[model samples]
Target: MQAKFLKSLMYEAQYKDYSPDFVMYDTLLEKNIPVVEFGSGTGRITLHLLEQGYRVFGIETDEDYQGFFLNKIKEKGFIDNFCYVTDITEVVEICNIIYPFNVLFHLNYQEVEVELNKLYKFRHCWSKLIIETDNIQYINSQSFRSKFNQNQDYFFKEFPRQSKSKIIIYNEVIEKNSLNIVLKFEYSLYLHKADDLNRIYNQIFPSAKLYGDFNLQFYRKNSPKLIAVCIK
Candidate 1:
């Protein structure tokens, strides 16, 4: 992602509420174990976990997002409870929870397999691995505009027609006064079906459980998300 686009996303978080995935992970604080969150964008979930007295180690690939993430943790005075690294292989400490919240969707099938295999090595180190991703069946192409701030607005559109195996997202930010585009970017990701994801999970961790939503409900055809929880 571009730096400007990432900055816009960080701003979006100021207005938009936390996702259901955040709520789901927050409930696991009672486990009282250290957490390692992959793709910890802007430390949204990481901050919540840290505020709840749980130690969290964030792993993110994007340098732009990492800068904002670091600033937020410092601002909240939760720097002690949180730390971050740009590479996953650099994580040597054992954590009880592995959270890749809303992250797997960005990987292709091959990349997903590679990541799962790498994570499998830490099975003994972490008791649980929770992955949250889109339920491909439920994804639809749509467009809408929303307020970014007092003087700016963002127009978002998704076009999933380019390929059967991938989804494309387009984002644009415009200044209301000048009606000029301030930022624009396109993001694309491989589309993974529920069955395909579950099959991979079972192959790697046979004891994994699949849920359709944040409520821990059983998966179904029309569910909005496919959340997998694998226990060691």
Candidate 2:
């Protein structure tokens, strides 16, 4: 069941902008760094890191995706170079290693951030952390409920009228003042409105360097699928 959900998501994500592999590989090639990916789905970024001979570790919440990655490592006999964990909050236990090649993308940012915060409770561990996901605004009064009703009433009629209230829950948890902004760009088409996204970006990542133009990816050149890289 987990595998099915991930597979479906991957199939959908392929059409979006920003190949995470391309971004990570470019950074690694330039910096000569190793990697550790959290919320890696089916070793999508993990496999690329492994193929490049980068020591990689992955944390996956989905058991089926975790199993799939484990099987791949086993099949390739990469006992020393690659590691994966199923639990969301498992701390990485790499000794004497300075930096790891990092590529992470999870659907649930609130859950993943809590787990990652637990795993790396002490800061200054990873030299780099790359994340990709839907943009959720925080500490802002945009009335996402109005947006949801305006955009999704035809499909989500069965749900509560204030369905977008959940968006606030996610934003409050994920967009706290812990991470510094690095880079942010759009990726998906169906996730957010472009105007809302730009406004949120200014609020959360006011200092982040824009990686590419708003339409650099497949976002109809005007969508709200943002791809951002931030620092701690």
* Highest-lDDT candidate: 1
Error of 2 at 87 (Å): 7.9
lDDT of 2 by residue, 1-232 (tens): 3323333233223322435445534552324454656656666656666776777666655665666567667888875887764442343443212112222221233443454454345434544433344333332444323211111111111111222323322211111133332212222112333345444445554543333322335323333334444344
> Local distance difference test, per candidate?
0.68, 0.41
Candidate 1: misplaced stretches above 4 Å?
1-15, 98-101, 138-161
* Runs in model 2 lying further than 4 Å from the true structure: 1-24, 28-32, 85-123, 134-207, 213-225
Q: Write one digit per residue (lDDT tens) for candidate 1, span 1-232.
A: 3334445364444533655676677754336678888877777777777877888888877666777767766877888887776545565656655555557877889999998998897565666778888776644443222233432344433223455667665656555556676666666666677889888988998888888888878888788778778877
Best by TM-score: 1
**lDDT score, candidate 1, position 183:** 65
Candidate 1 accuracy as TM-score: 0.81
